[model samples]
Target: MARCEFCGVEADFPFICSYCRRPYCVGHRLPEAHECPNIIFARPPDHVRKIFEGRLEEPARHVRPVLTSELKQLLLAWLVLGFCFSVNSLTAPQLFITTLLISLGTLGLGFIGHELAHRYVAR
Candidate 1:
């Protein structure tokens, strides 16, 4: 049988404080009731806490899109193309403007092909 950490009572169905991971009886189940130490550390510093203390509560929102979002994936695709082009140009400096254009076109097509493959696999 588990015992409550605060009142030392035998608990049949103890509630655990998530932060400190301690068991408590129904009466002391809440963090406040057990005077949980985590509550103090979880709070922001006094100076920063005061600034937003009176702000109106707003519904939670996503701050930013995921790194793998479409926009980021597209940007990464272009970046890889540019890097490959730069490395090829440096290695073979004799390539003419026509060759550069062909390389760019090929990379663009390759990027499109990759996207199509990804979509096909997803379906």
Candidate 2:
């Protein structure tokens, strides 16, 4: 089990950066405003600029600079698309099997993409 670096808590499901290989707990994870991989991949483009601007406007806390630009854009794009599909499914015609497949596929893709993102990003 990996212990959280910031909180010193034991974690079986530690969220680690695939690029940097740094382990962190959910609590210790980067804020949505920072430019971490989670921010780059998980955040919508609309919010990233606001995050960037906030950091500049506030001098109370230090913000880490983006260290690397290497990323799996395709995987991130696919995962984002899957999320959209799941959301849009609310209005989709209720085809039982189709809905089930879409839901399952979305979950599977999300899990796989998360791991792959870590693998590609972590050194």
Candidate 3:
């Protein structure tokens, strides 16, 4: 409910200027835009400024590895499922191997596809 000090317009959502501690609308929120008196406060404190400056000296490490921690559990689960299917399918010698393989392959695909769909939807 605060009004923009610079524009004198009532701000529905105010952005409080860190430097001057004055509420402003998005347009006049920046210290430069509002002609903030205490522009020196715009710079971060020495310790924090030093930490950020130090980081800039080193080349950024941007290699983000994809997580595969659940892979072992997923593979183990597929093995158990395949074994169960194979055991039950032992009665038919000719069609047993083909049926088990095809079913397990499709089941794994379906499971992976379903999980990916859920992830995308949530994201």
Q: Compare the candidates by lDDT and give the number of the best one.
A: 3
Residue 59 error for model 3, in Å?
Answer: 13
List lDDT for all candidates, in order: 0.75, 0.61, 0.78
RMSD, every candidate, angstroms: 10.0, 19.0, 7.8
The per-residue C-alpha lDDT of model 2 at residue 104 equals: 53
17-122: candidate 2 lDDT, tens digit per residue: 5544567787766634223554456545563333574565433567555553433554566656655556655666565447646755877577677867887798
Clashing pairs in 1: none
Worst-scoring 10-residue span by lDDT in model 1: 42-51
- The positional error of residue 103 in candidate 3, measured at the CA in angstroms, is 1.0
List ranges where model 3 is wrong by over 4 Å.
1-67, 118-123
Which wins on TM-score, candidate 1 or candidate 2?
1
Our tally of clashes for model 2 stands at 5
Off by over 4 Å in 2: 31-123
- For all candidates, the clash counts are 0, 5, 0
lDDT at 55, model 2: 65
RMSD of 1: 10.0
Please, what are the lDDT tens digits per residue for candidate 3 over residues 44-104? 7664233565564454578645656565666667766766767767888767788678767
